[model samples]
Target: MGRKLWLTTSAAVLLWTGAAQAQDAATAQTDQQDEATTLGEVVVTAERRTSNLQETAVAATVLSGESLDDRGVFSLEQLQFVAPSTTVQNYGQGNFFNVRGIGKSEATTAIGVGVTTYRDGVPVFPGYFQTEPYYDIGGVELLRGPQGTFAGTNATGGAVFITSRNPDFTGVNGYVMGQAGNYDNLKFQGAINLPISDTFAARFAFNSEQRSSFHDITGPYSGAPGDIDMNSVRASFLWMPTDALRVLLKVDYNSLDFGGYPADPALATNDPFEITANGPHSGKDETARVSLNVSYVLDNGITLRSITGYQDGISVFSTDLDGTSALNNTFYDRVEEEVWSQEFNIVSPDNQRLTWLVGAFWQQDKVTFPVTTFPEGAYHVGFPEGVLDYYIFGETPKETKAVFGQISYDISDRLQIQLGARWSESTSRNENVYTTYPAFGLTLLQNDEVTAEKTTGKLSLNYKVDDNNFLYGFVATGFKMGGLNAPNFYVPASSFGPEDVVDYEIGWKSTMFGGRVRTQVGAYYMTYEGFQVIVGDPAVPLFSSIVNVADETVLMGLEASAQARINDWTVDVGAALSKSELGEFYAADPRIARSGTCNAETGPASPNCLNLDGNTQGYAPEFTFNIGVQYDVHLPNGATLSPRMDYAHIAESWTSIFNNEALGDRLEARNLVNLLLSYKTDNWTLAGYVHNATDQTYIAAINAGLRYAGPPRQFGVNLTRTF
Candidate 1:
């Protein structure tokens, strides 16, 4: 019902305002627009070649730098509110990002991720490395559905591509921005570009942000748990020795110090801005990455490109698992990860009847993780109420290699066909050991090797109805590699199989009323096999493992978005509706599978090994939509004053596959509003924004058998200058 209402309302608004429009009176200014003419064409490299977004068959959302700033999106998690069929959730330790009801939700480091994230064309490892402040970015592209042909492994759900500004050889230019707001929030960001000769240039960017904690800790440990202190820097260089050859180098570094876990007491109170922890709680993250890209254009209109990238990062976090003032449970986790990759590509010119690209990619990744737990006697009586410190030290080294090729042929002036395929193989080895602090012979060791391979591809056909209307249909396949679980969890079920998906999609794109209005609608249906599920052990609450269901799962969804320029007001609206159901499968509910009672005839009697058929996937909301309007008011002082308001709604979603409301894993629906007012001139600008204007409280994650709340209402002010 809610989804229907949102769709109806959005359609009505667009239809009513579609006919009334003036060229320059109230213009919808976007980053890709020229302002002098109609809306400029948006170009994207999602297919390894620059192409008009309206002509691309892939379902993607492109958020330019200007759009991000106007929306005041500072973190990756906040992006979900603006994009359809996306969700980003965080608990005390890590973040989980999902698109179209597909993602991983667990506290393990051995398994691969379902969704892959790339920064400047380099894949970002999971955990802390994936969460970073968004500053000085060129644009962000969120691709939905199967993207295996272009994104390589671990892209079953989709991929996120973030591009940073590159060094330019066109004179000196830069910008600086400063922000201050409630809760003692402060931020500073700046960039400088310098041309060191006609062929060489360098650009440097930096960001520093500090914010006070919104949660007040009151317990044995009395300190704020939500404070943030982070700094990041990037340096890029461009060298063009000749017209045919170009070289680019980029280096990035980030450091973060979170005062404590950003979680409040769950099930104890309704307040989302208070925490009670008795154990030491803090988190630190550090990363350094470097990449070199070289491109050479041949005289035959063929281009050769090579990308070399290396990254290393570390994360240390401690949290109180009990979410109470009593020191009953605490745990600490540390992770060190490093990755190296090299890719080579050959591309033909785009002007010919046949455009093609061939690429080869190779990547190596290694990681180590350690954990310690402290549980008081109140929870369990298996042992004395003493600190049971355990460590998980493992070196999971993996090598992945892939060869992919894509070709697009224009059969006629109004019809085109594209076909792509990728063959990928991966080999991994896990040398792991689990040991206790006392060394009382409580140790576990494992040496495992695994190899997997898959062939994925996409086929699409596009038809142009006219110069301003287009239709497309495609079928794509995606796969994610499987891995072994830690021995500390369970030995019998130590490994899980790979997961795969097949997606069928159809979409339409249109630019109506002389480019004053742009709209897109896409519908997708996906079939999943060997769906990997991560869950906690019923007998041992602290242990987690992954399982692959025997039956197949199905998911279907529709997404629509529209942008309009109506005289003095610019309006943007988007909506998504999705329905997912699991096939018949047997699973144990952690909340009910207690007492440790099990037998062949009475399997897991306490919880009762039950069928999870027809259950919805975790965190897959059925309805989501957002609407925003910006009105520009011309001033007599030759400046502009703009006021914008944005609203987003998310329907209730399950946090666990069990789908039992009695366990409190289902989060209720929430509605949020944000407002921004800005005064702009030629050289400088000032802005004030209020986030979560309604001050709604909602659950963001259900981790460690407890719920974590999202942020509350907050306001901020920003000033930016350009030179």
Candidate 2:
């Protein structure tokens, strides 16, 4: 009923406004309704080639740098609210990012994520370091559904593409911005671009932000959780020896201290903003990444490109498992990861009748724990806990390689056919051991390797109804590799297979009222086999392991978005409605370790094991919608004043398949509102904004078997100037 009402309201508003505008346009127009102002066309670069968004058949959300600033989006965590069918959940130790109801679900390295994220055409590290702020960005593209052909492995649900600004051979230029707000929040941002020669240029950008903790800890904690302090910078150099050859190099560094991730037990009834923790807080994450892009154009209009990337990141985090001020009730996790990757691509000219692209990718990832060489006092992670409990030691390394290609043929002027495929192989090895204090004992757990290979592809047919309307449909397949799990907590160590998915999607795009309005509507049905979920004691993830279900899961959804630009006002609306159901599966609640397993003859071992045959996927709400309206008021002095309002609604969703209300297993629906007012001149602009204007308290994520509260209301003012 809620979904129906939301869609009905959206349709009614569009119809009424469109009709009224049409009547006004008819009185002074040609054969078609004409308007003085029209929406600008957006060009998407996620497809390995640049193309107008309105002409592309893929389901995507594109945001420009200015758009992100106008919408008050400073980090990746806030992106979920603006994009349909997207969810970004932040936990104490890590995060879960899902699109179309599939993504990370456990704290383990034995499996792969369903969604893949890329930066500057290179697939970067996932799961950690996601809180890094966005600065000097060119644009971002969120592609929904399987993107296996383009992204290769680890893409079952969707993909994210982020591109930062590149240096040009233009003259020296840059900008600076500073902000101050409530909660002692302060931010500084700036950039500088310089031209070294006629063929070489460089650009540097930096961001630094600090804010007070939202939590009031009553326990003797050694750190401040729920606080924010981070700094990030980037440098890029572009070299163009000739018109046919170009090379770009980018170096990025980040130093982030989130204070810590404050969380309370899922069953806790205390104020969400208050916490009691006895453990030491550790939230220090740092990373360094470099990418090189080189491209050359041939006389035949073919382009050859090679991209090389390297990244190293270390994350240290601590949490209170009990969410209370209990003695010796702390958990600490510290790790480091290094990755090296290379990709090569060949592309035909975009204007050709037969456009095609072929690419190859290779990457090696090494993740390790700081244990063996260092002693108890050095790391402190599992110090007293190591004596009481035990900690896992060693490393998990993986190597992946893939070859992918896509081709599109023009069947006629109004119709086209597209086909794409990818063959991927991943190999992973676990050389880990379980150990207690040296005084206690040590045991070798698992020293093994696993390999998985898959071939995924897609087929699409697009038809142009006219210059103003288009239709498209496609079928695609996606895959995610699997690995081995070390035995722990009385749970046996086992290997899990890869997850697979087949997606069928159809869409329509149209422009009406002489480009004054644009709309995109789409529907998708997907069936993915072997849904993965963590099964074990939730209190102690050391005992938890990612496992696969026996049957295939089904998901079906509808997505729609509309944008309009009148003489002085711009309006945008996006909505998504999806129904997801898990296949036949059953797992005894991890919280209740004493419960027996379920079986057909025995009926049920425990209430939690009763059947998950038709349960909804966790964190996947049935309906989501967002709307934004901004009016630009012109002044006689050649300046502008703009006022904007943005609102979003996310329906209630379950934290787990069990859906036990008594345990607070469900997240309540939330309504978010934001407002911004801006005053702009030729060379300078000032803005004041407020987010979460309602000041509602809600949980944004569930980790460490506890709930993490979302941010509260915040108001701020910022000023920017151009040189």
Candidate 3:
């Protein structure tokens, strides 16, 4: 069935591409270029060069401003259709990003995922911040496969980069948008650009959104509620102090507060679930970021650039495992994190065939989490005699430093080769300070520290079939440093080592029928070593932690996509297939001797037996595909109507690396459809969209026998005015 669907989709795309080419040829002879022009040309800096999407050698996808606005894609979660191998899942209050079925899962302390996220050319401090807001975004770039040598650390799976609208010095331009939807959802956004002078400019933007939940809980309580409120503002200044130098400074602040329904388990019987009538679980997050970029064009075709940034954020979240459970049964987690980074790079101009970039980066991150678990009716239920209470508090601090360099030489006009390398080192420290009432006799203080170093590299060869066609092959390596686990009541913490993977890929990029049709195809194989897997014992509580269990895994995949323009209509389609297998996964487990009874008052004494085998990696989906179509209609009144449709299919996947039967289940395939309608005049545009139009029932993420359901059908209308 999958193969048949793949063939049908491919045939349809090829037919459309052919039709677009024929139309382009006929129009080339004449000087008439009257098309709706809803799809604008996308410009990207994926390779640090201002080039069209079809001109880049790297396997990348670009989402233009028009597409973003028309689809009402205000967050990274809404960009699933922008690429073939990309999927975003939310676990707990956090987000997990997967590319080609490879990504890290959410945890208090673990670093196995192989992807990195960046905003406006600067890497976000930690990998846990993938859920950052996407307001006032100009475009998004998805670079597939390992990009360690080019994008720095954590690029084993891929890299997602977002660029925001910058200050414009040429003219005064701005836009305002307002939206209202079901569930009493409201949103407002606006941006303004000021041309202070020929050498100075300023831009400011702000957005606010609020919405209510769609699910109703009727278990034990009536009027259970869910709500989300978010606000963000950014201000930027551009100063051209000299003709050869330009500086940009930006400051952004965001705050998100939400209260929502908890994860409700599927009942054995078809009984309606109701809440216990307690307060809803809630999460609050606040972040502030400041960045400065300086670029200097020196003599002899050399340019120097520097990016410096700092981020500070704090989050408080509470989860009620069972909605009918009282508030005392809830779990509370509070986290605070601060990060700082600086990078400097020098690049040679494109005057010669040999172009290169060399840079150095330094970053530091500190995160502290305080977790507390309470029994049911801790506040109301009378404390039983001899009962005990406990709290867990820990802090993790990581520091990273690296120096990287890349150089590309054109062996000939038709063939070019590039090589790059990076040497990086990281250190992590975990400290846990706890207190237990009734003198539980457990250790109250513990500390662990781990450090690792690695050198990653990339090599690529590009062969141009012609100006409109090219083939490329590359090999790259990526690494994620390991860290220590916080001490828990049941066991002492352990340190882990770095995990690494090498990816090999061959791809082709072609602009077939003139410049109106573009297509890209690629195949890749990856091998991993020392893969990190999280393991826990269901028999014993508080045994969940990360361990380097398996030594190897092999992943192979193929991807293809195309975009074309036929008359006033545009179409885009894509598909991906992959298979992954683990080798020698049974060697990591060992039975340990127990020193004391399981219910001993002093807890398991001395050393406890640790079993760490047979764990499947998390968030690796075997098959996924996305297909889209868009068209534009020009009316007699000079107004244009554009509509777009997108369909996505995701195959079964595992949610955790440790393949425990209790935690492992095949997530059935899901079909999601989205539609958008928009009208545009000379200077104004109005749009409406429906997401998950099919109202499918699906799970966004699952772990440890728990699943987080995906959002239901949602429809909204947006109004925009530009001046």
Per-model TM-score on C-alpha atoms: 0.92, 0.94, 0.88
User: Candidate 1 — which pairs collide?
Assistant: 26-567
lDDT for model 1, on a 0 to 1 scale? 0.78
**Whole-structure CA lDDT of model 2:** 0.81
Cα lDDT of model 1 by residue, 1-723, tens digit: 465746745674565355434433334456355353355577787677888888889888887887888886777778888888888877643677788988666656656777788888787775456667788898988899989899977888888888889888777899999999998999999998999998999999999999988777777863347788999999999999999999999999999877766454445455766666676566777899998989999999899999899999887676676667655566666777899999899999999989999999999888765343332111111121246555555577888999999999999999999999999998878866443434355667778877899999999999998887789999999998888865663443277788899999999887765677777788899999888776544335445567776688999888888777645677878788898999877666654534442222234433555577789988899988888899989898779899999898888888878787766777788788989999999889999999999888887777656677777888989999988
lDDT of 1 at 387: 60
Q: Show where candidate 3 strays beyond 4 Å.
A: 1-31, 34-43, 125-129, 219-225, 266-280, 322-328, 370-390, 431-443, 489-491, 537-542, 587-617, 658-664
Candidate 3 residue-wise lDDT, 1-723, digit = tens: 478446744764675566555755644643344333323556667566566665555677787666666555677676765577777776544567778766666554447456777787777756444455677778888888777876665777788788888897878999999998877889998899999999999999999988986566554432224578888899999999787898999998888766643555432122222334343365667889898989999978688999998998877655544444443344455677888989898888976899988888888888776454342212111122234434456677888899898888999988889898999888887666443443466646657678888889889988887886778888888888887655566666666667788999988777655456677887889987766655443224434455554447777777788787756767777777777666544321112323323321222323353322323445565566677787788897899898988888877676654344332344556788989988999878888888889988776665434455677888888899988
lDDT of 2 by residue, 48-90 (tens): 8888887788998888888888877788788888888888787
Best by lDDT: 2
Worst 10 residues of 2 by lDDT: 374-383
Deviation in angstroms for 19 in model 3? 7.4
**Superior candidate under lDDT, 1 versus 3:** 1
Better of 2 and 3 by TM-score: 2
Q: lDDT for every model?
A: 0.78, 0.81, 0.68
Off by over 4 Å in 1: 1-37, 222-224, 264-266, 370-389, 435-440, 488-493, 536-544, 594-606
